[model samples]
Target: MQSILKQKIIGIDFSDYSIELLCIEKGFWKPKIYAYSRCILPPGVLFDGAIQYPAALSGILKKMMLSAVPNFMKNGLCVFSLPDSQVFFHEFIMPAALGGKSLRQAILHEVRTKFPMKFDDLYYDFIVSGKNHDTQNILFFAAPDYILEKYIQTLLDAGLTPIAIDVESMSIGRSLLNSRDRRKDVLIADIGSRYTNIIVYNNYEVSGIHIIKEGGEKSTNRISEQLCIPKAEAEVIKKQIGLSFHGQESEVSEIVADDMKEIIREIKKIIQYYLHRKKITIDTIVLTGGCVLSPGVQKFFQSHFWQEVEVRNPFDKLRVQKNDEKNKRNVLFSNVIGLALRGLHTYPHLRGVNLLQKARSHS
Candidate 1:
């Protein structure tokens, strides 16, 4: 493995609606943010976590690099994240007697049997959490081979070195939770433009991840339909009066409230599964991503769930350079920031889930 202690890494996240990039320098005590940028992706370029137009997307990435920071393509090591909806996650136990090649074979065999899809069609990885009496608990992650290849080829075409690829759930948990927070079981809800990712962390480890096909775009569309206004105008209205239930645009609030209730309903299903399976009760819920910027969204979640709810700020521990007002408060970059932190080895506990690690080793 390469030493990330003193390296500068560009972390990129590709969502259905936008692409986010962040450059950071890893310092001994703290990480320093160099520059960050977000570009709205053209429709049909990406859909349901699949790249429909690789060439067009790569062209946009090349332009984004040149515009964000001059000479950033030179020796720029990059890490990117996969959308949660496209990835598969499962937790299982394997006999501890298996070790070395035996353990590897056992895991592969189990995955082949338990995974719904064929093993040849996927790139899968696992993290062994720990050993219990006679078994080892493992968390598995897998993504489609074509999807991973498209992203890798896109980065290579843009003249960037791809170091690692991760999923949004792990990145969200790593960036939002502090050391103390990790010690306790918590739930993280990341509401992006097109999907909402719910992650359950037990004893500071990822236990479950679920993705719903609803997000900020759904709420905006609801507003647009209800008021017969343009999407742009509806988006503005949604942000200004989101689920507060008080204002002249209370109708907009009602629309957002309905969408939020659906999101919370899915979240509760995941919570219920965890509680029934592991007997773990999550006491805190951390909200992050672009949709969380809506007004009163946090309060709505707090009221709906008994757990303490709070919005995530990725710059809480890092020293942010002097920047404009917009960059300082941009919560949408949480996933990218987490990718950079992981690339920099900032959080030891959240390491080694990179999908590209095995490929790099074989190469």
Candidate 2:
């Protein structure tokens, strides 16, 4: 029997609250999304991008194989995203002469000596971002080793081959940037349940990331706490009334706005500093994750920053394999879609790193 490997790739993005899957099968034409599934994860399964309960997560993954994914795609090779909140990204300049073993040795030593965290505890990867007369820009990323192991075990238990692990910011960059025109410098504001990642991508490669302490969920929590409403009800109210208002004052909008002010402040600071230092302006602001679906969020960003803002829609350009696929999709799958794209290795311009380098081998 021929195992489903190279031809089909599954990209998975799972957070504390949900799991999204996309399987793209490459053929002669554009990559076709053969199967896709999304399901809500139970509370306590993942806490802040780290798996809290491995056995339960494995069980949930197994259920997806039986129910969400198609029978043929249940055992294919897959790539996953490491959430932005858990990974640290840094860009450094190395001698243009360094290559092969010497480059690796230099990067290894750099990480060992510079970063505050212990090198042994991290699963890391790097890619050369660009080059100049004497220096090559190297982008380095690392995440907790135990967290990656948990994810690998869960995927394996669900019968999927885990090929590589990627950082959330790079995955977002891959999906959002067009393969043909990679010239745009983008500022991605990925607002998640607990944090918002302010990522800078120059020419389709991630250059920097800034993490805001609280994010979209904080707004929902504020509404729930102040109004004395249930969380479920609060989420619905926040989404419905998100930063939009008429001539009169809206209580829900006010509450949401009040909570979002801190995040916006931090965002402005990052954007200002980046532009000032680099003397390069961002072409667009792409909004993704939990906050994007809310009404007027995209407009709010544009009005505040005076820049082009797009509410993330990972499926906007791709050709869906099935008509039913549209109904099952959302903005949150941008990271996973990029992970699948990474496995395909189609785009000539995009640069990414694979953290799972010797832990698992694939043909």
Candidate 3:
């Protein structure tokens, strides 16, 4: 693949439990990390993506800005990922009779009606997937006014510029697209700490994106409850054992296995529904998440789903220096790496089906 020449972009991922801040400077063959830092939230502060204590989060961002990007804090361009619950994504259609200005008007009208929040209560954007034969099809997204404003305000309040708000699923999707060609229908599942987000791309167009509440935390809690162990111990055990059933605690393993079975059933149901409704077969399943690193997860998923499966790795798109063995091994940072690529694409782009915003931004 050809190299993309561009500048640096700072990416920040804020979670209820931890905040991950990273910066990527431009490179010809590969991107270089300028800075990285992670901070855990204080206990009783916040839970799963909700800002229970804005002041606490703001303070953390403030300290992180001072420590992580001390030299160039002010006016630095940054982007943030919102919690899955606070964001909404849906597909819609407009009449074939409408084109050009008429189409634009129709889309805006649909946005006005379809969005859950009032027009004044959110910062909205969308992607035009393509025309469904004749009618225009689009994917719409809206983040609550307060959710977006809080991030912008937190940045402004701290002397950093938050230039964009995006979905984490799309950020990672861009990296996957850059590295591989998904000629057929496929599902990309990103199982994070609090939620598992699934994005279905058929022929390079995003057909569906679903966010499920089950994730790593759920597994941890299940282990904690069934094994009669502390949360921290359960967490360690989760990573070490995962779905492996290799340990002597047969009873605990059975309980964990049961929980995993439930999750798999739910995911399978979602996939089946999409396949049947859309009349598209899923050619493959790609898993990306911190959990994928857990022992035996890959084999477990392949065995249960009966489909080809793999982890997300963006190394194929980067030209690595032969001496940088450590960086070459860090495949888990694929999502953040993709988020960093946004600034270096030599063009303004939005991943997934945001054709409207892409055209609007470039114009």
TM-scores, all models, native as reference: 0.90, 0.89, 0.84
**By the TM-score metric, which is better: model 1 or model 3?**
1
Error of 1 at 162 (Å): 1.5
**Clash pairs of candidate 3?**
127-353, 127-354, 127-355, 128-355
Model 1 C-alpha lDDT per residue in residues 255-354, reported as the tens digit of each score: 8888889999998888888788888888889988777887889998998998899886778657764464555455777788888787666542236677
Per-residue CA lDDT of candidate 2, range 85-204, in tens? 788777778999888778878887887788787767878777887777899878777888888888888788878877677788878877777763378778888888788888887777
* Regions of model 2 farther than 4 Å from truth: 1-7, 27-29, 69-72, 179-181, 246-249, 321-329, 346-351, 358-363
Candidate numbers, best lDDT first, in rank order: 1, 2, 3
Clashes, model 3: 4
Off by over 4 Å in 3: 1-7, 44-46, 65-75, 96-101, 111-116, 315-332, 347-363
* lDDT minimum window of 10 residues, candidate 3: 354-363
